[model samples]
Target: MRWSNWADTSSVCGIEVAEPAATAEVSALLREASEHGRRVRPIGAGHSFSAVARPVDLAVDLRRLCGVRVIADGGGRVRVGAGIVLGDLNAALAAHGLALPNLGDIDRQRLAGALATGTHGTGGRLHGLASAVTGLTLVTPDGQIHATAPGDGLFEAARISLGALGVVTEVELATVPAFRLRAEEGPEPLDAVLADVDAFVASADHAEFFWFPHTRVASTRRNHRVDDGGGRPLPRWQSHLSDHLLGNRAYELVNRVGAARPGWVPALNRLSAATLGRRTYTDASAQVFCSERSVRFAESEYALPRAAVVPALRDLRAWFDRTRAAVTFPLEVRFLAADDVWLSGAQGRATAYVACHQHVRGGFADVFAAFETIMAAYDGRPHWGKLHTVDAARLAELHPHFEDFLAVRERCDPARVLTNPHLERILGP
Candidate 1:
């Protein structure tokens, strides 16, 4: 019933806002919008940096329609309301001795939203979150609900539609028996360790690293399968100190100082990376996958060939050395194998994902631009949920199934009822 004239996403990009409660309401809303010749956009938690969720006319917020339900245990799949956040769902899954096969860095966004944009985490042998989706229930432009699954022509396309095709109501996710992960965190020499990033990625069940920008220091994380030993959880106070204080608070101070005086960033980076110390813990799969990122920063991430990471990062370092712009936040590097999703960044390519972030109020343009330039040379595919400036023409070159996805979108949304201006620009009409 209410709309924001102008809104900004988590990354501070301008957007429009609309609220819708359920699939039926969103269906009727889209139909009415089609009659009036207006565009409709469905938004989740506004976690994306790209304008994909921005609408010029109608914006549909699915926040109120979130819940987790078990549709079929025998089939090893469950139906989750599209708007359910990953954090909430994981808790529910824990109760049922079930968990998602994989997860991204954070769990703040809606399940449908994360899959729609091909959001992913790090694992050489694992696929992305979208790949876990065995089927989905989508509300079409004419207010018809369709259940899609593998082998269905519309299945692959709907798996990662970027909210351009229709409003997704519920998704059937393939799950695994709940498992525990032993997580280890420590500081590593940036140059020495990166010499074999590929091998390291392949060896670890889950591997991700954070390199301090403007410095040769990085934090390495490796998680592997572990027996369910009865290890007690970290005390709330200790967890808060380690995650919130040391990880976010100290990080914020480091950025504030570096932003004010660029020259101080390098030493700060070195110290910050070292300050992570060494940590070891065991937790549920989702708990291990999620990390608290309270420090506000804007990020741009691209997935390139696994072999391209070192050279691309070297090129980025060179750019940083030459440019006057200063970046304080760390750069995160992750890995993922190729996936079947049409719009997935790692589609058909064993990829190394490089993410560059800058302090929210700092000058991120130069560093982000430099990264973009380096990635462009390596046939990089930008994450649709992250910050980028690629349109349909550029995107088509990166994705092999681009045209196929478009055709499916056309069939599902002939009138483009769920499309926003940003979706149109990237996927075209």
Candidate 2:
């Protein structure tokens, strides 16, 4: 069968797939593969734009291993199956009067994929998704089942191991009580926001902005925790209009036009910026945090020091002005606090994430390459699930615990059964 990632940027053909429903079944499959010396790669929802999850020999699909199990009645801890999609997990948690502290804009990724890739959201005071993990149940390449938690040495590395240490079958996450968010979003002057980006980020519980190239306007969102009851939400019709019609359908048409006429991109982007009118609403945390993303695009994101965000955006804007690159997609900027997870992009330093995207039909090579060059000066850490050219040699310098994580990987998969070309490139052979 053929397997392709959600972005359709990476795909493999004629690979054997195994769908194991139980942990014991997964162990059996891995043991047999280990004895035969056959390579294996576990797959989630294939949401990664990179080739990290591209299976070489055998593909273990974990979709059947889903569903949430509450660790205790009111302990705020849940053991979630690795196969569960984040959206589903969020709903389950909401039903239990609990929630993950933070979440990325899109929630289609499987729990394991999000945790493995160090997925994060925008919040100067919050850490990445992996930080919420208190425990993990992993099946090593040799079929050994190990339950690990903090202080286990392997736990930190395994949290964001890019699926190298082993296959994560289940994750125990520390959750928060169910909450609502009062979201204030609208267009703002890009110059003003960039002039004091730090203050802007610190002003809210969660804040992010998207700047359209060739436009001085920035579409900004600031979400703050709010009382659960007596909150106002966008009417159903208006919500559908904004999320589906303008956000996806019209956005797709605009990209199509830009792809056809590169010279008109500037005007199109200006129009797109103008349509982001002001709106305020209150909703459940998950509903407010995530939006419908039906438009297809390829993206490259980098996490840099919090202080580098303004300078990086300035350089990027200059590049767009100098090269007249016709990109329809807006540049997304977000923030996250420092974390201790060994391979996390935000590890050890407060981070500002800059994500650049291009319509799938548009040319992205030059744009992404130029963006990478600009980020390099800031010592940016590339998101593992996103497109990037950095390799192990440079990665080692970027990550303080790179060698330690490698040691754990070596111990877990001595035969290197869980590695692929992408893994080898980033983690070394």
Against the hidden reference, what TM-scores do the models get?
A: 0.93, 0.99
User: Tens digit of lDDT per residue, candidate 1, span 318-424?
Assistant: 87778745777778899998877788888888889999888777866777887898999998998988877778998898899998988888888887777766677
Worst 10 residues of 2 by lDDT: 224-233
Model 2's number of clashes is 0
User: Tens-digit lDDT track for model 2 on 1-429?
Assistant: 999998899999999999998888889999999999888999888988899999999999889888898886638999988999899999999999899999999888899988888899999999989999999999998788999999987898889979898888999999999999999999999999999998999989999999999989999999999865866889999999999999999999999999999999999999999887899999999999998899999999999999999999999999999988999999999999998999988999999999999998997889999999999999999999999999999999999999999999889998999989999999999
- Runs in model 2 with CA error above 4 Å? none
Error of 2 at 407 (Å): 0.5
Among all candidates shown, the one with the greatest TM-score:
2
Residue 69 miss distance in model 2 (angstroms): 1.4
